[model samples]
Target: MFNEAVTQGDDPGAAAAAHAHGILPSADFCEVVLEEPKADSHGDLSTNMAMQMAKTQRMAPRKIAEALIAHLDDKTGMIAQTEIAGPGFINFFIKPAAWHPVLTAIHDQDGDYGRCDLGKGMRIQIEFVSSNPTGPLHVGHGRGAAVGDSTANILKFCGYDVQKEYYINDSGRQIQTLGLSVYLRGRELIGKTVDFPETCYQGAYIRDLAAELLARDGQELFEKDEAAAIMPCARYAAEKITRGMRADLVDFGVTFDCWFSEQSLYDAGKVAADIRYFREKGLIYENDNALWFKTSDFGDEKDRVVVRQNGQTTYFASDITYHKDKFERGFQKVIDVWGADHHGYIPRMRAAVEACGYRREQFDVLLVQLVNLLRAGQPVAMSTRAGEFVTLADVVKEVGRDAARFIFLTRHYDSPLDFDLELAKQKTNDNPVYYVQYVHARIASIYRKAEANGMDLGGFSTDDLTALSTPEDVALIKALARYPEAVALAGAAMEPHRITYYLMTLAAAFHTYYNRHRVLCEDDLRLTRARLHLITAVQKVIRNGLALLGVSAPDAM
Candidate 1:
């Protein structure tokens, strides 16, 4: 709707004025005015380009604002009013007509309402939930999985060629610990009283793996030399845990396109080859019995070791190869979703990418903070030692995958999320998943009831959406119009939680409309049909949003 104003030679954002004034010019820039919402004083969106350029151009801000305003088409329908407020800050009052077209567009496009050509099909890789294959995913891993999965979905909707990946840590010390843990448990199961080390896994799943091994191979596996058998046992345990982890994620409705292995980097000599590249480029040097990369030069706290004195690669070493491998696959952008506890690792990894000759900005990191699972009002403590840490599968079975995914993403990725078991299981407003699904099911109910009444809505074209002019109707349409913007913002910012919040707000507006007014009133067919059009659009958005979160959008509760 606002595009008409731009096409009419009105103030076309800051870029045009900047170019005429011999200032920095960029086609990518837009002049946005932040005006009060006419209801809230917190200005809907604020930009200070005019004020910033006043001194550089040797002109007063108010004068510059007047010139910019002259170019702005007064016929811009989205702007009910535009005024210079507070030292050249242009504020705009978005007109209701500006929100009306959204309803028609939604009815015309259906579920594809929010998709845009913003990315122009740029290839992007998103790697997340690369948790070690030593145990089931904890709550921390759940957050990353939700964020990464939703992010990829949003990017795909925005016309990006997105590939979702999960990196497996199969060649690490954690795998060794898992092997020893399984072997020790196997020894106990076979009538040996070996002391089980506390450092090994004590989860019941490990015992189950040991049981499976016992059932399949008997005690022959453990009869071999300890050192000789440890690696094989660990490999077996890792495979079992990895399989279980995959099943758990699938149960949670999460799937990845690739499961890249850390072992592959070693098997292919990719890590060694990358280290040699750094060595040849003088990006790495030996100091104090350690092979250190010049990470400090690239913005790390200091230099980091690629290889330890014992001739083993560090975690950072495998990571360099992993990142390089991702870039070499021809993805223009790589996004990593990690638990916030690993925030410190970002700078180093970013530095490694730059040192390896890739653009530092090519790598994006989304730090998903912790989730505190709650069962009533109390915190749910997780412990692997007690064999009581909640698995992703357990959460899915308890509250369901749709509920699990939505609740996990209900908060901003940077903010701490509280997942209440009781609330998630509730069918009312306490559960956002149910609320959104209720709207979808209600729309289906309308369609069924209308069909039974011999009312053919398929013949009703959306070209007559102007019939929907009530305050609530317009409000609902406004929410529908924001879908594309919401999607674009979420993709650009790498924030999937925005969609969760949008669904909740949209669902609330829908339920409120449902409670107050009937969509199939016999005497009001025109308004009823129009409202159905809006409801149908709402259903598409709710279903699409839920799918992005790896949640199910059921037609019936």
Candidate 2:
């Protein structure tokens, strides 16, 4: 819970200066950071502030550490003892009584224990899973959705005004191809032989859409010209597929605050207006009968084509306009969750944001790598073009939403993941979600047992924690104390996987403590009451963490 002890009331730098007046620099020279020791034998918290100031003081680190310790003030009696470890590191062993505040804070705060004010209500927009509406969302898009949604949740918990968005790519060549795919399938159903090009979508859903169109409007659709028929087919298919996508995402525990359409940019003439604004500022120029953006001026490798010589705008042009609109809407930060294949697009997009008069730091992109779904360690092949890929909905139906989301976030977004179908569906310790959820359920079972024994679950106070003096009790308390730090760090790094890692670690700690300690001691009613309160805090923290990841923490397995 205490990241920097020196900065909190106890100023080690000032103490050192007071000990050796004018010999060392002021406390502002370097930040004194205290870290929790990995091994309990080392100490509760350790710092290397003495070594950090050794060069300026011209003194050995251990000697400086000893001097600082001798002059340090412990008015609150939080620290039980201090030791100089290897290479002049000062380790402080916190008093057992000091940890009682953490348990009390956990109980007092409950669901809001880990929430922090890191963002201070900054407006942030996270756009993710903006997949083309030509097909169903595959597992890869599912990963993006999990990452983006969890990141937004983490940021929101950190006091940011977060907005989740889904950018619809409803207007493009992909839409045209979707329309053609459905139109060709419609002609075939009407006994007219039509050649389906490879460029068109080949999914069975296209055929379904074709059949639905015929049933809705009859064979009269075949009377329209091919050019005129494509738009109607495209519009219908896009609308249907987009609706299905929304349903899939909602079922997967993801709901967007906004659904932005790419076609709206063109409809409002924003793209042309943005290009004109850039041209006026000399950022856009006509070269070889094409308009080029000078992205190279803003750290891009070279200029990019915004408009082709054929007088048609490229996707880049629309992207520029979309980002411009985002900034104009007054979001302090914009985060785009994209597939790994779009990794190279970051530079140009950052350049565009900078050209729009915003700092590059304001724009962030999370590139989610591919997920290779497996069944009992064997790879399941997938190809969207061939229409052979497994849909996200299928996976959710096979292994529930909680399992799917927990597995998706087990790895960092930049790393590839192998989601085993059999493993995810298992109820044993091998499944990460089950392992974590079991902690919550196990604690709930303890409460039920307490109720059966007529043990009072209420009237918990700091005095009840007096029985919590064992090493295992301290370790669990320490783990519970780190939840706020974990949430704040995950938000600061924009990595939701960090929360998953923290959850696993905390769950393991709880399991270890539960196995070794008897929470319900018939001989000692005080100890039983104390242990119940401790585990209750653990359950609350676990439930809070799972909520951030969009996963459920069940009271029963």
**Candidate number of the best lDDT:** 2
Q: Each prediction's TM-score against the native? A: 0.86, 0.94
User: lDDT of candidate 2 vs native?
Assistant: 0.90
For model 2, what is the error of residue 377's alpha carbon versus the real structure, in angstroms, after optimal superposition? 0.3
Checking candidate 2 for backbone clashes, the offending pairs are: none
Error of 1 at 537 (Å): 1.9
Full-model lDDT, candidate 1: 0.80
Per-model C-alpha RMSD: 5.8, 3.8
Candidate No. with top TM-score: 2
lDDT of 2 by residue, 1-557 (tens): 22222231334455455444423333333466999888899999999988997776555777667666765677788998899998799999998778988988998898899899999999999999999999999998999999999999999999999999999998877888888899999999999989888888888999999999999999878667899899999999999999999999999999999999999999999999999999999999998999999999999999999999999899999999999899899999999999999989999999999999999999999999999989999999878768889999999999999999999999999999999999999999999999999999999998888889887656766797889989999999999989999999999999999999999999999999988999999788888889988999999999999999999999999
Question: Residue 142 error for model 2, in Å?
Answer: 0.4
Cα displacement (angstroms), candidate 2, residue 512, comes to: 0.4
**Total clashes, candidate 2?**
0
Clashes of each: 6, 0
